[model samples]
Target chain A: MNRVFITGMGVISAIGNSVAENQLGLLHGTCGITKGTRLSTRYSGLLPFGEIAANDEALKEILSVTDPGVTRTTLLALHACKEAIADAGLTGAQLLSPDTAFIGATTVGGMCLMDELYNDANNPANNSAFAPFYDCASVNMYLQKYYRLSGIVNTINTACSSSANAIMYGARLLRNGLANRVIVGGVDSLSRFTINGFNALHILSDEHCAPFDKDRKGLNLGEGAAFLVLEKEADTNGKKVYAALSGYCNSNDAYHPSSLSENGDGPFLAMNGALKMAGLGSTEIDFINAHGTGTENNDEVESRAMIRLFEEPPAFASTKSNTGHTLGASGAIEAVYSVLNLVNQEVYPALHFKEPILATRLTPVQVHTKKQVRHVMSNSFGFGGNCSSLIFSKAG
Target chain B: MFFIHQTSCISPQETFSNVKMDLLHVSVHNKLLAIEPAYTGVAVGVLRRMGKASRIGMGTAMRLIQEGAAPDGLIIGTANGGMEESIRFLKQIIEYHEDMLAPGSFVQSTANAIATQLSMLTKNKGYNITHVHKGLAFENAVIDTAMLLMENPGNTYLLGGVDEIASYNYIIEHTAGWYKKEYTSNQDLYKRNSAGTIAGEGAAMFLVNNKKEQAIAELTALTTLHSTDKELISGQLKAFLKKNVPSGESINLFLTGENGDARDADLVASCESAFGNETTVARFKHMCGEYPTASAFALWLACYLPIDQPLPEHMLKKQGTTNKNRTVLIYNYHKNVQHSFMLVTKFK
Candidate 1:
């Protein structure tokens, strides 16, 4: 059996721009959710969000991206992917090899330029350059082209759980002997299309989101990207191994399009399936990065699912409480965070939680604590009942 | 090995449960729209809210259900997923200034909406994923289905690829020089010798598992190339064939996804020439037109085409009369960029 290990990780979220910065913020218990100052949405000032500090122009300039009509989604993805590739010390030859694969996930592909798409669609002379970048796979396609990657390139869009599935799929590619290395992650930018869409769903919080709280209102929409370089253990002879991607599973709730079942069947099945794949017992999982979208339904249902799984549910926290819900990027972002927990043998606390949901009455880790973290689980459930769980273990 | 137990397609032709021939030579006016089924099994209220892709996808699912199949998982592929609803929602956001917007179009506009709808309708709580790559979308879904079924040998997965053409999407692609300048009948798609191809839309689904019993066909080999260099692709295809097909064994039928675009002729020719002249070659894009997942229609055709009968005159692109088509190879590429190959053989 092939053992998959995470060789490198890169992340840019509302809390920070790099893995080190995010770790610092997590240590200091900094909350990134605030009234948006960079995004151009009408609700930017009217509602709080986990908006990245940099604007699209600043990001493009920082990344030296001169491509015309490239969306912020692609820019963010390129930013993190570049970091992950560099951190892994992958050479141009290695990246260009047919043995390397790139799997990306994004919900807001080019819709980040929602106004532009509308204008071009309505204009009689629709010679829009952004038209090519409008599809969900355009972000990955751009990455593959920019990096000159020649391996199996594909995109998965299962809403919020998109990137987790990407990670799992990348691992499968290695285990199936189809690829030697894979760059897996996801990205999503703040777009009026998604903001208004999520707003219409009435799940946007006016204030900072409070995950697993009795008074939790809704989730704060966020924008970010994350990528991780994964390689088989046999190939990581002298490479810096961040963690081992031990197990992963994707399961559907099949109850609703935008909500989970009351029993949290999707969440349970995903977590349990992953554990079974890892050949680990429930008690072996030291900490969990809960999905905890701060939504009324999600928080409670996730709590019930956790209680049902673990006799004494492991120490868990919702990083979304800090970065807000990053949508498509949350799964990968949190996976990186979970790897951080295993690497540093510490756990970060969920922010803005005063009381647990009355029904399940579960409390997340409320303070940053150093612990003997070995195995960590991260959960991400998307609007389409697409739920996925990934478990990362400490590597020697 | 992955076995296709049952297959269903909602193509421009009458290719659903009844694979009737539409040999009228009727011309498609720049676009080939799928001839949708009645969908009488679904409720009127529910059907009213479903998008065109969802309707075709669910209609196929219903057909599979009638055939007594309850798949445990679903994996779907689409290039332009629910674009009709996405464009509508985007237009409304711009028109109404994002006020009083309903979530119906927004929910259905996602790339994974068709798969989500299928999962919700069938109450399938198993593995579900959606691939959105341009030309290799369905091919990637097929790969995922094979991987999943390989991991869980007994589990049956509903694998599908669906793409629909909308006015906004078509106009954008047309403006980008993806469609021919003059409106040509689909029947004359190959004869036009034009630089661009006709746009098309449809849905194709298959119940796939590891079991060979009662299977329609077995997917033996699959490979995708992401290069424009013909020599590189040729070398890779030779290696793939050498590994999958027996030594000195020739492929009986070669299905090519040539949609009458002159720019793609070189690559198409390169692909077909890989097989010898003794092999019978066929094309299906004229019937289904050209979309990202149009290769799926070709795949569906590969499963249903009669084994012993002579080739349909309209489907034959080149080569001799159809012999025993026990072994088939489906070769397709989109705009000379994403190339794919799939080898299908009889279950026996």
Candidate 2:
């Protein structure tokens, strides 16, 4: 089988603008959660979220977006894609190659634009300006158009596991000899829709989310975009290697629409499948990025799954405590954080970890610690019992 | 080579059980809507949180997996994943402008929610993927499943195609004038010379595996055509057939997509002329309202057509004298934009 390698990565989160900045934030244990400045929400004062400081116009300016009617989601995606392509050392001249493809994952594509259009439809004057963003057929179409790449372009929207799935699919396509180099990641912008959606489920935390803590409330809604340029291990450029995505598995809970199984069966199967694919055992894993959404059901269920899988669980923490849950972009953003952990040789603390859950007896690493981490397993489970786990190993 | 072991569809026509031509008996005046089974029986939480789209997706998914054990992979396709909830959430945004928007609807608005909900409902812990490619939404999903099977043999995968049309809002803007202005019945769909057909929604699921079975359809070959040129389409079909089928044997049945659109109808006519009298012809769009993965419903029809004794009158374009049902061809072209073709042969 062919080996897939991470050649380059680009991330735009609340923590920092570039991969280096994000790494610094992770190292210093700086939390990105803050009061909303861009999104005017009813819970702005009550809730802390991992929202990007820049507005849509600034993001468009950063990407040099000529089209005025581009969706905020698309702008964020293009901004990250531009950085990723450049970080991979494959820019304007290099992207002309036909062997490259772009695979993106987004939960809602151009939805913010749609919301604006719908709002403007009542007034005929604003309708003309919002017409360009009305095409919501496929989110990948916009990315393909912007990148001007003639290769196969696709998007996967499997909820929170979306970006992880995109990365997994990119690796598979490369292994299957479909493309030589591929850009894979996810992007989502904070919308009233998602903020209120998590709120409706009563899973949105008004205060700073406490993952794996006894007094945990719920998740904080965040939004951003992240991408990784994946290439064959043998064809790596001169850039510093972060980590290689070794194994990935996606599964459905089939238990309920909104809740996971009590035994964490879905997550267990996904983690086991990923481990088996990577040819690693429970003892081989050094660190785990748990999908601790700070929700009562998710933390407990994930802890139970961990206990059932390993005799001595690996050092693990839910970065959601620091970055908040970015929904569709959570998987890719967390994967980037996992790669940073492996590259930096450190385990970032799971913010606000208190006593272990009474039922599972699992406690996450609460403080930042330097360690000889080799392999890191990241988990992203979303609504609809869609559980996905990706195992990333340091490139030796 | 993932063989479609079992397939089931709950559409407007009587397509769930033994397939025959009972679709013509469906009143043309009355819009042919799916005779939905009780959602509470299939979905555990249908009583509390069942939305229109989730209910349809979960219902069809459960029916597809009912006969066998849970699949190792689950993939779903939907153009608008949860537009019903999305529109609802959008309405909340409009009503409240920006304050106190309902989060439940917002979360469900993501296109991948259907797959997520299905996974949660089924507790399936395998490869879960969802694709939305306009008209080729389901076909892309089928292609993905095939690719996965090629890589991992002996693995079972559940592939489902589902979409729902909310009463107003998003559909009006997204689809525009795709549905008839006046409520035209399903029976009149073929007779009425309209630019678009009546808008409808449904969900269909198929359990496919690499293992051969007595009652199965070997999905031998699948291809897609981006262009609408009839000559190019014919050439692609001939090349695909030559690669998959025996040299001299002709396709037993050629199922063509015959939506009410004139251009699509012409394309189907060209296909019928290409096959001539050597193959039987059938059409399915009139039965199931036009949607992206309506081809999935057609594939379901092809799976049961051979086993069922009598053919339904509504589906028959040209009745064949021969009774041999060995191979079936499915060709679907959506709005002269996206074209997909599949070959399914009865397993010995």
Candidate 3:
């Protein structure tokens, strides 16, 4: 089996529009969660969000997107993917090679245009221009077509863990000799569809999320896109290797559709399985990027899972405090952050964490500290008990 | 190669168990909705509220378990999952102005709801995932299942594909000319050289493992292509067959996806020509209608067909009697964009 390495990474979240900008925010401990100004929804002014600073028109202008009915989801995905491709120095020929594949994940999909879809669905006479881009596969299909990619292409939608599973699937493809390299990641643009959907569940935080904090209320919905160029070690000889993707595992809780078990059985098994796959002991992990959606159930459950996994749980933090919950994009976005931690040998503070949860009595990394970070384990648990843990180690 | 230990389906045809191929008849309809099976072992309260996709998916899993197929993992593919609930939630949000709305529809609107529901019901919490690519969704899940079996040689996987026709999505597709202007009976689906094919929905589940013992069929090869050029797809399929099949081995049964759309006639014919003239060729979309994951239905049919018996008369596009029906090759394309090929053989 061939080892997989991250040759390039790109992200555009509420924190920043590029990798450098995002790294700066992380280093400076600048939280991106704020009152929404870009998204046009009833709750835009009522609730907090990690809304990208630029509006749709501005994003289109920057990306040179001229397609009339293109959803913002596609634009954000294109922006991040373009940077990742450029950063990896992948030419059009490399992208078009049948050896390279694209795996995209998304929860919102074309519902980014929720109002328009509703209108078109209700009116028969209206020619639905966006109909072609509404399916979960549409974003990846658009990317494949845009790049003229002739390789294996697919999309995964495991909700919050969608992108994490995308990364795992890509690695397996490379290891199995199905593809030489894979551009794997996810994108989700905030829309009324998810906003109202999450609102109905009463998990949307009225204030900025406080992950792992005692008084944490709920999660704030965010939108962004992140992509990582994963190449087998043999193919990435001369490339700039960000980190080696050493381990990944996907386990289901089988307890509930939207909630984890009281014992965090899914999370514990996922983290434990990933460690076993990497052939590493629990203590070998230097840091952890917790899923920590800031909801009462997630924070507490994740905390308990950590305490169950390690003799002394490694220093951990939740960047959802920085970017809100990007939903489908959270896994990849946090993955990029986890890789950054290994590359920089630094850890960022979880934003609004005041006190540790009473049950686990675990306090997250509260200050930006330069540490000897080696192997960083990133956890992403989604609705439907889909729990995944990915371990990224320093590339030697 | 992965062995199909068991199969279940809730489709337009009565294919859930012991499919009577001889008694089957051609049906007529634009919307080929699945003929739901009895939820014999399912809880009544949960069955009352489950969506069509979930009911059929969970029902098939329950049936397999009762027959002694204990899958350690669950994976599924759907082009549009829980779309009915998604539309309902959106409509409610619009009507209520996003206030005091129920959470049930919203919770079920996610694409992975069916797979998660199966996990919750079965408590088989090993590896779970959902693939939502359009035409290749089911194929992607199949690919994952193959990899998982190779990685852990002893494990069994419950793999499935599911999709349902929701009015909101159906209307949007209809307005976009994705369906025939006139209602064409599925029995007459190929008889007419029309603009569009009928819309259909179904769920097909399989218990697959690496062990060949007691296996019904073996999946030898699977490939997906993303291209609009028919020539390119044909060349790729030829190459795929050359790489996977041994020399001089003949394909006995060739299943083709011809959804009765006039524009796809040339492409469909071109793909069919990739096989030898002696290979028995048949089409399936007429029976199941046309949906993204309808190829799952094709696969289910491939496993159930007897090696010695001839295919039902209505399903034959071209009949050849030279070879026993030991090998089945399924070729399907969606809207001339995504195409896939699968090779399945009777397990020795």
> Which structure among the candidates has the greatest DockQ?
3
Q: How many residue pairs clash in each candidate?
A: 0, 26, 0
Q: After superposition, which runs of candidate 1 have C-alpha atoms over 4 Å from their true positions?
A: A124-126, B22-27
Q: Ten residues in a row with the worst lDDT in model 3 chain A?
A: A36-45
Candidate 3 per-residue C-alpha lDDT over A1-396 given as tens digits, one digit per residue, 9 for 90 to 100: 678999989999999999999999998888898886565678878899988988889988998889877788998999999999998888888998999999999998898887788888888797567877877788998898889998889999999999999999999989888899999999999888889888888898899899999999899988999999999999887779999999999999989888899989999999999999999999999999999999989999999999899958999999998898999999999999999999999999889888888888999999999989989999999999999999999988
Residue-wise C-alpha lDDT for candidate 1, range A1-396, written one tens digit per residue: 878999989999998999999999998889988886565667868888888888878999999988887888999999899889999999999999989999999888888888777767678485567876787878987888898898899999999999999999999989988899999999998888888998989998898899999999899888899999999999999879999999999999998878889999999999999999999999999999999999999999999999999967999999998888888899999999999999888999899999978999899999889999999999999877999999999887
Q: State each model's TM-score restricted to chain B.
A: 0.96, 0.90, 0.96
For each candidate, report its DockQ versus the true two-chain complex. Answer: 0.75, 0.38, 0.83
Minimal lDDT window, size 10, model 1 chain B: B20-29
Chain A of model 3 scored by TM-score: 0.98
Model 3 docking tier (incorrect/acceptable/medium/high): high
Highest lDDT: give the candidate number: 3
Q: Write out the backbone clash pairs for model 3.
A: none
- By the lDDT metric, which is better: model 1 or model 2? 1
Q: Model 2: what is its DockQ?
A: 0.38
Cα error, residue B123 of model 1, in Å, equals 1.4
Indicate the residue-level lDDT of B99 in model 3: 85
For residues B1-348, could you state the per-residue lDDT of candidate 2 as single tens digits? 468877777777665554445535353432345656665445364434656666777777777677687887887777766777777777777677656554666666667777766665655567778877666778768877877987888788889888775544333433444556566776667777766666566778899988786547888877765565778677777777778888778787888777776546666666677675757787887777777778888787787775435456666778665545568889987657567888888763
